[model samples]
Target: MKTPNAACPCWSGLAYEKCCQPLHKGGEAPTPEVLMRSRYSAYKLGLVDYIMKTTHPDGPRFQADTAAWKHDIEAFSKHTHFAGLQILSASEDKVMFRATLFANSQDVSYTEISVFRQHNGHWKYFSGAHLDP
Candidate 1:
């Protein structure tokens, strides 16, 4: 199910208007942590443009089919719900995070040490290593 644009329940702790929606609307997210939360919301909302824009170009598995990839992500998110995110630490270009997501009729969690880089004065997600949930 698609989340309402007026308010997101993804638990970023900010109302939709103040949070991910803007990022989805082509606004720059200030931090990797913010970008990460918005990315989760993008999956929930199926905002392909936002995902493609924020994703690091150097990241592996770059696909040319953005719309198809969006559909794939949405299909998965529809079967689940975004729960919450915790930012463990952050530096100039990296962030450690733990995100709680409920999926497949069950709740699953994951930790990621995400690396980001500043390009053209904007932060873009480059890569990440999944940690034990």
Candidate 2:
């Protein structure tokens, strides 16, 4: 877990408390790109509950195994290190970004285009497609 004063995992150049922490704590993200960044931060911090809560109910990625999901999230967060994030694009309810992650002392980067939906004035992750780039 990241301390409140640590640099944000999203590489936003802001303290966690001033950046993604509020989103993790229930504050609404104003844009899909912001939500994507907050979700990446959530993964780095092992905030599975926040991840689940921010996921849209109708999203294809929704899973019923809360315990197993939390366990998996914790394991990944403990074993992997978040390196950085790069926002490629943001349009309407979609965002494209690349995340740099390290595991077993090796770098692993991936990009994805994520879709978001606004529900009751809050943006939630709806789904995503991994990009080949």
Candidate 3:
């Protein structure tokens, strides 16, 4: 996990604390793009609880086996290097982004369009469709 003064993994050109740490600590993300960025940061940091909390209750991710999902997230965070993020588009309730990473010495990137909705006034990740880049 990045320290407060470290550069944010989300590639937001800001300190981790200023960029995504607040959201990891339960602060509200202002928009879907922000939420998507923070979720990427969470994956990089192995903040499984933050990930779970930010995922909408009705989402497929939330319906998975908790222990297994947490294990997978932790393993990915520890084994892969998060390289960058690109915000392709965003609206009030949706964001499309590309995430780049290096795993087993191979660089890879993927794109997804994620849907979000307010749950008790906080934005939560509802669903996503993978996209070809």
Candidate 4:
């Protein structure tokens, strides 16, 4: 059952309505949670523009080539599914958390402590460190 409006279940721990839907629907979310969830949705949906829009300009890893990102995102989506997010700490513009990602299948997992920043009233991803499971 793949409907365009259906919420993705690849973690971020949010149902469609309470999570990425607002961002996808042209609403604003200020918290790291919202931004993170939306970013995960972006990955699932291949929304390169949304990823660019949410990414911090000042962040060290910001890449301007959206086309390249689009390709990378597509490749990632083919092998990845967001499992869930565990927020370790957060402030107005920063979030540190462990996100579990499923790849190949549920039998394989990837986890990371991702960092995010809020820029221009939106949440953007910057960098992250892999966590040991």
Q: List the residue pairs that clash in candidate 2.
A: none
Candidate 2 TM-score to native: 0.90
lDDT of 4 at 3: 57
Stretches off by above 4 angstroms in model 3 are none
| Model 3 lDDT per residue over 11-89, tens place | 9999998899888887889888888899898888888888888899987768568889788778988898888898988
Q: TM per model?
A: 0.80, 0.90, 0.91, 0.72
Residue-level lDDT tens digits of model 4 in 1-133: 2354455543544467666776877777777766776776777666667776776787765667768876776787667766666667776655666666778776444455567765665666777666677
Write down the lDDT of every candidate, Cα atoms only: 0.75, 0.89, 0.87, 0.66
lDDT for 1 in candidate 3 is 47
| Candidate 4: Cα lDDT at 72 | 75
Write model 2 residue lDDT over 1-133, tens digit each, in one string. Answer: 6689999988999999999999988898999999999989888888888888888888987678878877877798889889999999999999989889899999877898999998777999999998886
- Write out the backbone clash pairs for model 1: none
Ranking of predictions according to TM-score: 3, 2, 1, 4
For model 4, the superposed segments whose C-alpha errors exceed 4 Å read 1-14, 106-111
Q: Per-prediction RMSD in angstroms?
A: 2.6, 1.5, 1.4, 3.1
Distance (Å) between predicted and true CA of 13, model 4?
6.0
Model 1 agreement with the true structure over 1-133: per-residue lDDT tens digits: 3344556644666678777776777888888878877887776666666777787776763456777876766676677667777788988788888878787758777899888877678888888899865
